[model samples]
Target: MLATTRNTLIQLAEIQHQLQTIHEFFNKWQTNPWGFKEEYLSEKVLVRFLKYETESFANREWEAHRKEIDLHIILQGSERIYLEDATKLTEGIYHEKEDYYLLEGPSNHFITLSSAIDQENSLFLWPTEAHKTGVNVTDEAVMVKKMVFKIKY
Candidate 1:
């Protein structure tokens, strides 16, 4: 997993394609319909935009993809995302259509994201990284608009 900001994107010039795709998505997807849907960025990368109310960690399930890397970003509101090593968690059934495995265990760590500020915290979670997202940052549930870019691994 890696967390970074928009300013650091240029420094990763070696990964030109991926970086550019992310930048384009960041600019183009800020507005439009705020809901659960997929937008193709390229042949190998797609953006899944979601907007919903945050929930408690207990209600969130750990999930990991088998063939894609998830790049998560918050476009509106705030939420916490829990992440941990998928291999360390109890194995669960893999959903082929979704390309993810359900896991059960304690999250090792978490990161909070807020769109009101210019923090622009972007996280990349590889297939080996299991994560439970859309978690509330505080005791009360708040709505959050998030985008997950699915890139080929």
Candidate 2:
């Protein structure tokens, strides 16, 4: 997460530099069975493997950890992420087993993201942003590369 605009700019530049390295790594490992792994600028920046199954979606209840700036990079397949407006969120019965609270459905705002491999390297999500992920309509599974950073207010 970026603490300020300046930090966001810095992170963006560093991410751009790392994108070149990531592309090379992807070229080699895109078809590899072992997959790939790497560390970014610092421990605060991370690269990890992500897979989303077809017709599967994750309903999540998230609260701010300070503030968050997420860089979701798709490395393989495709999935739709449903985001709910924070202002519209209302408390629901806690399901301790799931480790997250459920929000009343019939959301007022949402967005769909398709395959974005050749277009851009990163997408940003802010704090208090309620999001439901892994909505895939395709038969093929989707792989994504994500870097989650904490933004200090």
Q: What's the CA RMSD for each of the models?
A: 4.4, 6.7
lDDT for each residue of candidate 2 in 55-81, tens digit (9 for 90 to 100)? 554443333222334546555555566
Worst 10 residues of 2 by lDDT: 59-68
C-alpha TM-score for every candidate: 0.82, 0.51
Clashing pairs in 2: 1-149, 1-150, 1-151, 77-143
Q: What total of clashing residue pairs does each candidate reach?
A: 0, 4
- The alpha-carbon deviation from the true structure for residue 23 of candidate 1, after best TM-score superposition, in angstroms, is 1.4
Error of 1 at 12 (Å): 7.8
Model 1 lDDT per residue over 1-153, tens place: 357777555535445687588787677546554444887878778888788999999998889999887888887888888989998899799988778899999965998888876775677786778988889888999988778888775
Runs in model 2 lying further than 4 Å from the true structure: 1-40, 56-66, 91-104, 116-122, 138-153
N/CA/C clash count, model 2: 4
Score each candidate by Cα lDDT: 0.81, 0.50
